[model samples]
Target: MTKHEDQRLRIIDRRTLWNGFINLEQITLEQMMSDGSTARLVREVHDHGRAATILLFDPERQMVVLVRQLRLPVFLQGESGYLIEAPAGLLDGEAPEVAICREAMEETGYHIESALHLFDAYMSPGSITERTSFFLGRIDTSKKVAPGGGLAHEGEDIEVLEIPFEEAIAMIRTGEVCDAKTIMLLQWAMLNRAALSG
Candidate 1:
């Protein structure tokens, strides 16, 4: 392990509890005892959160499944009403694969067989405190019927959309798709798609 990894494991008794959504103890920030004249400071933070996103790839049909939903934050940035994104959700004590599969069923109504983990990364290190684990799943679109939005009580008004795998690539080129996590997963698919599909 490198110095950064060593620093990351230096947390002392971090506490995390659930009080509705999620509540975590504020990490105590300490100044590194480096010999410098009031200069550089290294800060390490421990995040008590997790997120999961799925790129639904139908190998047989050459299509990718996505969902359109209204995101107020994006709308406030002067965009359209609906944002196209893959089925994703926060890992509320559930495993990443389990959470993503459940989200796929709720958002798109397709029951997934298994999800393959692509990679894990942080989302916006400048501000938000969150890490996302991305997964790629080979879905069977043959059994897929009409789209299915999630339950209303969860405030999810999602609309399922299935597009050609190539078309999803085109959306990234035309700047139609702007979601960061979705873009990353799609790019990864573009690179290792043949192996993933086979």
Candidate 2:
């Protein structure tokens, strides 16, 4: 790798603060020699670190569970004020499986089995340091019900909805499934639905 790439990887500054989030230092661009090119902009982002999310699906029932809640960002964007999202939460020192299972129970009121990690990636490279680990979980249909509201302390008022697999896919096509993570998870489920059903 070039010197600029190396510099970008290095953390030049870091500040830890309250409110459970840290602000990372800005990356300084540097000039480096590379194969036949103008000066490259070498800058790195300080991220919010890793998080975990789950797509709770019941293979036997051909249904996937999602939650609806008001998202402030969408609200600011003049939306109708609710977003459909997967069951998710930050790692907060817990393992991804543990975190997702707990989130499923807390957010949906269903005792979910351990989840399988599908993949992990950055949410938005442009500005956010939010890396989310996406998981696939198996839930029983008998447990499917309204998740009720979320923790009032956190200002979360969530409503759980268990939609049929085909209907969920149709929603995605209709642009109703807007959340990136949820979309990705649903696509993954679509690909594996048959095998998962067997």
Candidate 3:
């Protein structure tokens, strides 16, 4: 932030509210107003660190590999928790590329030679502290070293789905594919399909 922006807010205290699978922090601070005044505010930030997500596409087949798995949070919201999404996982102190590759092997059983780095994004900035690195990778069936069904111990009973590009995109339109990360990656592929094929 700029020097003028620095005058905007002051942090009074920061405390941890909860720390488990996810960390929650309460920040007591004040923000400056346009009228040269400050407003006190307390904002809670859910810190889950960062993550990496990779969209694996087959240029020749014009298909993508996704994982269908249950999300408890979604289920608790009275919706079907089975979500189709790109391979993703927490960084866990590893580099984004390394994390994505590990998650890919664990979830889909594919060993990728390399992946193209896309961008970094905040899934939900309103209250979450997660910033996910995005990537794209090209793969074929020949690269499958094992049956891609996810790890058993992690409670990951992932159902690997390989669908045509058009079908995957259509699923988004009809609400079949509702995961935000998956949707974003699919749209990106659509825009860069020709380049990817080359």
Q: For candidate 2, lDDT tens digit of each residue in 42-98?
A: 355556767888887888778888989887878899888698989788888888789
Least well predicted 10-residue stretch by lDDT in candidate 2? 11-20
How many residue pairs clash in each candidate at the backbone level?
Answer: 0, 1, 0
Off by over 4 Å in 1: 1-30, 33-35, 38-48, 145-147
TM-score of 1: 0.80
Considering summed lDDT, which 10 consecutive residues are worst modelled in model 1?
Answer: 36-45
lDDT of 1 by residue, 45-131 (tens): 445478899999888889999999998878898888689988898888999999988888888989888889888998977534688
- Model 1: residue 92 alpha-carbon error in angstroms: 1.0
Query: Which model is ahead, 1 or 3, in terms of TM-score?
Result: 3
Evaluation by lDDT, superior candidate among 2 and 3: 3
lDDT of 3 by residue, 1-198 (tens): 775468677888999999998899999998889998889999999998999999988887888999999999989999988988999999999999999999998899988778889889999999998999999988995568878788888888998888988999999999999999999999988888776765
Model number with the top TM-score = 3
Candidate that would win on lDDT: 3
Q: Looking at candidate 1, what is the lDDT of residue 128?
A: 49
Q: Candidates' lDDT values, in order?
A: 0.80, 0.76, 0.90
TM-score of each: 0.80, 0.81, 0.94
Q: Pairing residues by index, what is the TM-score of model 2?
A: 0.81
